[model samples]
Target: MKNYNKYARSYFMPPKTSMKWMEKEYVTKAPKWCSVDLRDGNQALIVPMNLAEKLEYFQLLVDLGFKEIEVGFPAASETEFTFLRTLIEQDLIPADVTVQVLTQSREHIIRKTFDALQGVRKAVVHLYNSTSVAQREQVFKKSKEEIIQIAVSGAELLTSCAAETEGDFTFQYSPESFTGTEIDFALDICNQVLDVWKPGVDNEVIINLPATVSLSMPHVYASQIEYMSEHLKYREHVILSIHPHNDRGTGVADAELGMLAGADRVEGTLFGNGERTGNVDIVTLALNLYSHGIDPELNFERIPDVLKVYERITKMKVPERHPYGGELVFTAFSGSHQDAIAKGIKWREDNAEPYWNVPYLLIDPTDIGREYEGDIIRINSQSGKGGIAYILEQTYGLDLPIQMRESFGYRVKSISDHLHKELGSAEIYTIFEQEYINLNKPIQFIDYSFKSGEQFETMIEVKKDGVIHEFTGIGNGRLDAISQVIQSQLNISYSNLLYKEHALGTGSDSKAVSYVGITNESGTIYWGCGIDVDIMTSSIKALFSAVNKLILDQ
Candidate 1:
């Protein structure tokens, strides 16, 4: 707060106003996505990736459907130059994909950058010069005219180089810090480059306007992009592009709004990795469109694989809470959120909805290699009955009765709260088995033989306190008969027994799972579960489980 006097707004607003981009609610189509992961992302790493890693990353970008990828500033380093040459000399560059290389306005750099592109089928020779007022006054210490000449000279050099180059080449010009530059000056430099390249429908030039430091809000950047899109010379021949960094944490927003403002392409790194705060996240931008019913054209179906490779090569961990890509992004830990998500998932499965309208989830996690049972309804102290029950039904096929689910939910929450940790599906299953299923503490099951006559006659043998006993009882059903034998012989008084059963799955190995609930003398409820190959045995076991719970509590 005390340093407020030191900061001032460095971004410039366009001179005229036509806020047409504000009218669009969402992006209707995917932009031409150019991944700068190798160039922008690599440079930002604490330990920049080696040549081998760069090659792997380049291949990954191709696999992910990037048509244009900024490989590196080939003229800046031997590694960068070697990487470019490796792609060309090894014939790794795909015929359809174009590799773009960055270069400054200087001649030798431009010349060496051009040399690296020899034998390539197609390449983009990108030229850039800083045109911001701050760069002019402080960094470059040059007048506006001098800056314009630097860009003009670079354009001229690219023209001469392209004439002699062996590969098919396209020109791209960026007023590097476009957002901080005056609109008129940025427009002038780009048009001058266009005048030299003479871009047409067949060879459209990309005029990338980069928010190099992201000095303003996203809307201001959108207005600047609109101004550039409207005023750039040879409008139809230009692919208006934006490269937004995340200094203000709005890179995704800037790219989306810029596309709505008539820009045709977006140059960003995956997961927003780049210098300073980093470039816009192409993954988020693309998936945003995908969630809105538009095709992003990029395959994110296996995002975990992508994340593994990205982390291994980049040496940067994707935050657990990062949008779409993080591990816990789809997981719900809050009770209310879990409940709604559980209900939403069940509704979708039962109704066969055409669209993804799951609660709290913008897109189905399964659409990107995440599961609902394991990844969606995570259990913690805040988890609820719906979530616990959903996990049971989805993971283990143990659909508890509603009342039993509520009772089991509180038991799970209490355990998780005491342990101070989240419970996984397997852990929850273990707890269910240990605490409720087929429990025979204090009273144990030995043998049961039933004969149906005027009523159900059952003879059951049980062991308690190292003693074996036998009892006979009659009731309307086998479970009721067992309950009557236990209450009458053991004096374990309980009533209002409720039971439900279903096959765990189909086929010979399928087992019956039964749940039982009973009310004790104190009006307190106890629940239990049983699993067995025989439905009758499972129902009997469930009754005993409920009795064991009641006895243990008493």
Candidate 2:
């Protein structure tokens, strides 16, 4: 076997110095947003959406107040062409909104793209070509001069074809993999295209520069965009757009910094669903603005429902760890976090002004559609007595004693460790009742039967310490029946008891856990829990537990 010298090569690649130059050169402004969800997002999916789903998603984008939407590349497929035709023929295009379409720099496809836009009210024809040295040599097998010719020729074709349309049309061009392209050559090509098309202040053109594959730091990316924005001749007429990919997982930061560098428009998909890693998450970007006391204009409260629709259409699951819209985004499992959130919420409730200094809360949960109940009460190994007690006190208003809270905290830690997952509020309540509330009481329920649909009748039998007590009664439900039987047999008088039933597990084999909170004449509340395969049996057990607690308190 031939032995090779593993230490022959250097560990690190030489850093590119131009990155610093690019960062210092550019400063950007907020760009007009144009969502490519219907076109680019669909193409990136394994099972692309059909016509109906496309139209539905298009309407949703329109409803989101996006004035410009990339509908599809009409010349690519028959389905795409028909979809654009449908938008035109049905008059579905909103009066103010402009539909954008993407196409290669090829003449035939450009002609077909224009042919589809005949009756459209307003449209943007986006033309792009690969311009990087690597792409020019490797992908297109063309020299620098050839690639420039391809781009300029495509722009001229778009200008001539757009003239035949009745509705006003604008031109937009992108240099694919623009960040890595030589700055001087990139400018030369863009300037030449502008000259051929004569896109001016009256007929503005968008010059979108995508960090197609992020090759360096965010500052480097910012510098590239800023350099281009400052050097472009028709600065006022040019709409500088940035489309960053998440190859290095810095797409959002890159887009944001690029904006500060002078980017005027953002092109992205919802939740950042696009090619590998994904695009800059528009949800995160928009919500970041909202959280910072800046108005993002987009209403994010409808995000969860919107995500559901996108999931169905795209057949992709939104990761639970996704920021702002994930299942676990707002859930707190840490002891300190839960304690801070609990205190924050209480302070907000008591104070006249908003409590802005809440420690664990980054943003108000209610700003989105999530409730406060679901925000802070996640149980895990790192969680503590405060979280457990908060759930018990909040859900049932049965404040646990200090010692009891410590005991319950141990139980919670055990359960979280065993399951290796966070416990929901209902699960916490069930576990607490089973371990603490019913620990000393030995009430063995033999069986319970109920006959319903008219006058409800229920019979229950209890064997306590080997002595059987049987009772028959008539009431609203099995709970009321069991309560009446217990009162009559045990001769106990209680003031008021409220019963609530919740699911232990989901789907077919779901067990029901019932909670009964009984209040005495003194207005002190005692809570109890019951669990069983049947809901009625659970209710009866819960009621009995509450009664037993009432007697103990007395």
Candidate 3:
């Protein structure tokens, strides 16, 4: 904050104005995606991927439904050249997929790039030249006309090479660092390149505009894209593409707004891997469309697999909080958020809603191969009763009563708070069993038999202080009858016996689980849980567990 005067805005604006992209609410369709991981992403890595890793990643991109993949700058290195040759010679490239390779405006580089494409079925020869003002003034020391000549010469060379090449090939040109170049000059160079390629409907050309150095807000990039889209030559035959970097941390935003501004293709990498921050993340961009009900065409159903491959090959860790694909993106650790999400899930189930409207979740995690039990409601000291009860029902099928859930919730939170660590579902269940379910403390229920005629009558046997005894009592219900016996035999006083039960599983082998709660003389509530093959036995065990808790408290 103290060094504010040292930096100035380095971005340029177009002379003409068009704000039409602002009116659009969202991208309505998926764009043609090109993964540049082998080229831009590989070059940025401290230890670039080897040939085997590159092959593995290429197959991954193909499986993910990318129609175009920039394999590498084939003329740049032997590894790149060998990889391209290998894909072509071994017939590993799919019939519907196109491989693209980058080249400079120089003739020999263009020639070598074409040689790498030899024997390939379909390919894109991407040509690029720096057109930014800073590059023209300081880097190249050339005028605008000279830069145009470089692009034109490259376009002419590509035309001649394609005529002689055996494989089917297309042309793509980029005014490198387009965002920092004058919009009119950028348009001028691209139009000149189009003059040579002569793009037609049958052989459409790709014109890529790259934010080589991102230097402005996303709106400025959108406006620049709109200007080019409106004025580019042979617009019908040209596929407008954008390649945005993340120097300013707005690469995703720039790509999205640029797409809404009429660009048809995006060139990026998985997880946005590139130089100086990174390229726009293809995963984020495509999933953003998926979340809005637009089919992204890419398959990310098993995103965990994708993340594993990406990290294993690229040596880049996907942050735990990364959007849609991270570990914690769907986790609800806060009490309020967990309660809302639990209720929202139940509302959807009860109403059978067709769309996903759960609170704090834009899309269902299960859609992307994430689970609800562990991934959604993680329990910690910050969690609440709804989450704890939801975990119980989901993992072990013990639905606690509303009041009982709160009681168990506080108990679990206390243990977690004392240990200074989070509790897993199994750990929570173990705690529940230890503290509340079927507790055989000072008073233990050995067995119970009941007869219900004019009134419910029960005889129960229990062990108190290591001694066994029998007691008889009569009441309106089975649980009440047992409670009366415990009060008379043990000399304990309590009231308000509340109970709930549910079938834990299905078929003949299923078990029944029950919860019981009661109030002590001091106005405090005690809760218990029981699980057994018989519903009646589970209920009795739950009542005895609650009574033992009361006696232990006394």
Q: Model 3 residue 424 lDDT? A: 99
Give me the overall lDDT of model 3.
0.92
lDDT of 2 by residue, 251-273 (tens): 89888888877788888888888
| Model 3 residue 428 distance off true place after TM-score fit, in angstroms | 0.9
Question: What's the lDDT for candidate 2?
Answer: 0.79
Q: Candidate 1: lDDT of 332? A: 89
- Any runs in candidate 1 off by more than 4 Å, and if so which? none
For candidate 1, lDDT tens digit of each residue in 193-290?
89988888888888999999899999999999998889999999898888999998999999999999998999998899999888899999999999
Cα misplacement distance, residue 393 of candidate 3 (Å): 0.8
| Reference-based lDDT, each prediction | 0.91, 0.79, 0.92
Candidate 1 TM-score, C-alpha based: 0.98
Q: Judging by lDDT against the true structure, name the best candidate.
A: 3
| Candidate 3 C-alpha lDDT tens digits along 1-554 | 79999988877787878679999999999999999999999999999999999999999999999989999999999999999999999999999999999999999999998889889999988999999989999999999999999999999999999888898998999999998898989999999999888889798999999999999999999999999999999999999999999999999999999998999999999989999899999999999999999999999999989999999999899888988888999999888899899999999999999998999999999999999989999999999989998998889877789998888889888888999998999999998889888887877788889999877999999888899999999988888888888888678888888889999889999999888888998898888887889998888889888888887787
The TM-score that candidate 2 achieves is 0.75
Clashes of each: 0, 12, 0
